[model samples]
Target: MTNENNPIDFGAFTEPKKRPEPVSAPEESKKEKGRGERQEWVSRQPAAEPVAPQKATEGQISIKGPDHIIERFKQLCKDDRRVYYDMLEILMDKFEGK
Candidate 1:
């Protein structure tokens, strides 16, 4: 369970370095926030308001195909940096000679 006689020699290790003391906020910043308390960075930045999700206008369609073919189609779309449905629409339009 235990390896008292290891083949490799790890060698002597040096002592861990001590962490630096935490820096207090500037006098002006402490005065703005309140004395002795650290000013959090998040408080300095504007608060993010919740955004409403936009609804998609286009209707959705389901697809059925061989796993390998589907994977290759998805990979092709990814390589072209195009959305799967957008790529299909473009291909269909091209085939229509439009």
Candidate 2:
């Protein structure tokens, strides 16, 4: 009998589990694919290139609250656009300057 609090010895199981062989890489394409051709096949391109970095405005304040706070804020706006705008208005006024 083993102690309930003692860790189990997995050493008794020495047999290694056999794994399936991995698939080999696909053979290289004989034909060359141009960038334009790839783009045409893609239903949608990824998001637009990120905006160019701008120097932070002088005295600009940035604050980050917990995920719960953000989640709650989002929940407060549950399917309502006005609630989101109102919350932004209050937040901007309260913390944008501090």
Candidate 3:
């Protein structure tokens, strides 16, 4: 079996695959050393004080719609809460002539 009409010879494609070189022990040690140095630097830094949660600056808007519509909307946003909020922002922007 052969592809006679093809300009390129397919027989040249069967070259032996080259195996990847193994990582030397020193390289592995250096990686570990680098990680340890990073951890040490991070640990040396001053700990941040716990921040209290800030209340929403803009008052919340409650939309009263049919239960099925609200349920469908919630289902659409099942993957992410940001999707729903971002969509609301987009709609509001369109209405406000932004």
Candidate 4:
């Protein structure tokens, strides 16, 4: 109801300005929170599928017949028998050193 020209001063009733409180060190707040965050992230991950006891392909070789067997045997012999001998020699040398 006061006149616009009078413009009442309510500053006297207002609260005084407050200085801000200092922030605590980041580590004090973050350590506990970080563990919880990690636990949550781990829980959200998908669970791995359980392997079947009797696997469909267990003991089943795709290639069959005597020709395939002969070919496989020849391949195994040709692959790296020399490498196996070299590895054995290295192991023996190490054992002798020990």
What lDDT score goes with residue 42 in model 1? Answer: 66
- Model 2 vs. true fold: TM: 0.23
TM-score (C-alpha, index-matched) for candidate 1: 0.41
Query: Model 1, stretches more than 4 Å misplaced?
Result: 1-56
The global Cα lDDT (0 to 1) of model 4 is 0.61
In model 3, what lDDT does residue 83 have? 69
Assess candidate 4 and give its TM-score to the true structure.
Answer: 0.20
Q: Alpha carbon lDDT of residue 40, candidate 1?
A: 56
Q: What is the C-alpha lDDT of each candidate?
A: 0.81, 0.65, 0.72, 0.61
TM-score to native of every candidate shown: 0.41, 0.23, 0.30, 0.20
| Candidate 2 ranges beyond 4 A from true positions | 1-63, 90-98
Task: Give RMSD (Å) of candidate 4 vs. truth.
Answer: 20.6
Per-model tally of clashing residue pairs: 0, 0, 0, 0
For candidate 1, the 10 contiguous residues with the lowest summed lDDT are 1-10
- How many steric overlaps does candidate 3 have? 0
**lDDT tens string, model 3, 1-98?**
25668778777688789999996665556568675543243476558877889987765679999999988877767745556777677668999999
Residue pairs clashing in model 4 are: none
Per residue, candidate 4 scores C-alpha lDDT tens digits across 12-33 of 4668789899977666465676
- Residue 90, candidate 3: alpha-carbon lDDT: 68
